[model samples]
Target: MSRLPTRTDTPPAKPDPADKRAAWADAAKGVCIILVVLWHVVVKDYLQIDWHIGVPVPGLWGALGEQFLPLRMPLFFTISGVFAANAVLRPWRVVARSRVAGFLYLYALWLLIHTAILALAPDLPTDRATSLLGLLEQLTITPSNLWYLYALALYFTIAKTVRRVPRALVLVPAAALSAVAAAGLLDTPGNRAGLYQNLVFFLAGLHLRPQIERWAATANRRRLVLTAGAYVLALAAMAVAGAQRWFGVWPLVSVVAVAFGVTAAARLGRWPALGDRLATLGRITLPIYVIHMPVLALLHRLLHAPVSGLDGVGQGLIVLGYPILLTGLVIGVSLALHRGLLAVHARWLFALPTSRRPAPRHVAAAR
Candidate 1:
């Protein structure tokens, strides 16, 4: 004991607020991506079939997806805004090349990929550009289900352009646009409705970055529970009053849901294992989001016979388990495809090719 040198253990370092905020955003993104894939699985795969089961699979799952309408895309756009908060401040050309160009390149590339794959699975029940004009329409005037890419390209441009404008001037009109779109006063065909309704959220995330970061940094179990309760009560009130579609109602509901989402995600980040998994998914959401629909479409066609044969067997379990299993499968297959593509040096499918070869994971994943 006397001969042995005394040693002292160092105390563990406290988690940094910045790291916490990043993890919180990643976890929130993870939740959003899963919901996106699940929505597609339900609508495009589950509801597309004639299960012929006694259970009201379509109605029940449809209603569930509808309830999540306020949360999914709004939180997604908001988180995107938060990530691009600094990018907008960079030189215009840089933002153009990195954000605008990157998004548009992916949009055009995937538009073709989706069109080609979806053409073969025409009976799988998804919207796609059928002709050259339809492709042009999707490219210019209207966007397809892959509109998120188009929206991001446009949003980044708008955000960077208006970064010098008064926040109220920019946000008020964006909010009005959302209200009108939500109220069905605007004609937002295809996924244009999402493109229109979510700009306010993205702008809010960009404009209110400090507040959002502060909220995430200070989020706790108590605050999360309280915020979630308020969100539920608000939803209940809206439902009771039949104002879910009122001009301002949807945006308000979406805001509350975003609050709850952020708080819940922040709290989730405090946990080590699960948070890490979610954060990892969050970082790679672009591949899952872009590729899931096509994967699901293909799977639906390939598995049609098998899935249909299960119609009468364990109807109850199939009702709930089918969508969940399909969602997991779509996500898994898409991720595997992404890795496989990278393994073959086909990274350009996900990112813009540069003169100097880009990194294997060069895709802009902020969205």
Candidate 2:
């Protein structure tokens, strides 16, 4: 099986570590994390009004969320795959220490934090298991929003095991699994279904990293236009099929939508100022992802009714604007909290408690 160049390669010119941190990739991640927070806010804050009032209220926000669902998590997992491409080539111990252990640590830590919060707050609406056995089941099976972290650990393990296999062989079965999951044929409980559904895109990202990198490097106006058109069409098809309740092929459409979505995000990341800001956001996505939910939940509890009395355009503006505003607030607050935690020697909040050697002279000098 052919492989992309790894850090082990003896190239004539060393690639800049900074260049390895692709601005576009970071921008794509930034867009993904923002969308995630926005989706959660809209669902919990705005759309819950219908449930709260005991009527199915029609709104553009819910429709918009449904339409973009395919792109959101799929894009996130694919981007993760792109980063994992190189990591998968490293030794098993290194891969375990860095990717597997890192993700598991965060997942376990946050699982406890979220469980404790829900347990302590009796008024908060939580469907999570509260009984000892139930809590054990949840810890073992369902991971909630932290499912992505768990999925990454699983994918990394699988990737290492199958690293010697032909890329096409690996991806074909993975895609089939995604299709099966999307089609509702797999019927696994809880996050297992999501794990299956997203595995293909992650594998595609890992297997096709070289091709994707080459395409991005050489992408031009025509390719961008074509990709954008394809993405729009895919979303339209998905919408129509979804309305008809045709579930079997939604994952196939999702694959196309995610491919184009990543492409579009990459192109948009070329803008200097916007890309820089997004790249910075991307760098802190982990903390943002972990912290944003609690912030949104608190904000939702405190201000869920602030815009309820508004009408027409005022309602629409609040519905649309509040999420963006709250997303900004969540990001800002999360960053501040992260910095404060770091300042107080609370790095364990974000990372495992470990120590390492100082940076190499050349790498530090490059910075």
Candidate 3:
């Protein structure tokens, strides 16, 4: 196995201080986080409940959500992979202490918190193991929303191990494997299958960091036009494939969508007001991601039932508008919970006690 960087090994150059690369990355992450939250709220909670309660489900939001599903989580892992590029070049101790430990802490913490909540409220939709052995088994083999955290730890470890390999050697095989996995060639369970499906994008982000950064920096109009055109073509192809039941084509379509989505986000980051707001949201994405699910779950319990005397359009409006409202509420409450409650009262909600650090200088500017 490849070992981590040592004293003799030169560290990767720090990200350019003058470059707006991190800002664009943050903006991308911000957009992704919102989509994730909305996907869960609209698709998982609202749509399912609407179907269960015999309400006429609106096609608009559901269609839009499905269209972006592939890009959403893939963008997240890609951005994370980019950041992990920096981590893999650090000393082994730093990598272990900072990256591995931090992710594990949050994963374990939230897992237990969610597990406890499920155990206490057996009436909720979430299922829990009744016996201690069963609980341990679940904990070992299963992770709910916190699977992202688990995958992050695994990805970091793998990235470090392969740091010495030629980028093409690793990336090409990974991409092929991801395509196969996405096409249902991987026989793993859902969560594990997700890990396999996303692995290529993560590796691509890590290996292609230099090229990606260059892409972000340049103002290449031709490249933008080409990317947009390709994305449109891919979208059409995906729609045709879906209608024809050609599931195998989806993996490639997903890759194209991700590329276009990331580039678009970078372009959008050039807008002053939007970029600034997105960067701020991106900075706090961790807290929002960690806490929003529980908030949404609670909101679901309260809001799942359909109201009487509303027409299909009115119900559709409520179905659409309510989730956005819940999303905003989750974001706002999560921010307050992190800053007010967690920051002072219980910092361990999102971090290990010892892992806490002072805010970065650019944090203020991002806000």
Q: Pairs clashing in candidate 2?
A: none
Once superposed on the true structure, which residue ranges of model 3 sit more than 4 Å away at CA? 1-17, 51-57, 118-138, 219-225, 243-248, 306-317, 355-367
The order of the candidates by TM-score, greatest first, is 1, 2, 3
Q: Best lDDT goes to which candidate?
A: 1
What global local distance difference test value does model 3 have?
Answer: 0.68
The residue-by-residue lDDT of candidate 3 on 11-124, one tens digit each, is: 223324365777778778889889988877776565655432245444566777887777788888887887777779998887776667767777778877776655543434
Query: In candidate 1, what are the lDDT values of residues 11-86, reduced to their tens digit?
Result: 1133354598878888888889999999988888788776777768678988888778889989989999998888
Worst 10 residues of 2 by lDDT: 1-10
Comparing 2 with 3 on TM-score, the higher-scoring candidate is 2
Candidate 2 stretches greater than 4 Å from native = 1-21, 50-58, 119-127, 243-248, 305-317, 355-367
Q: How many clashes show up in model 3? A: 0
Candidate 2 C-alpha error for residue 134, in Å: 3.0
- Give the Cα error of residue 253 in candidate 3, in Å: 2.1
Error of 2 at 25 (Å): 0.8
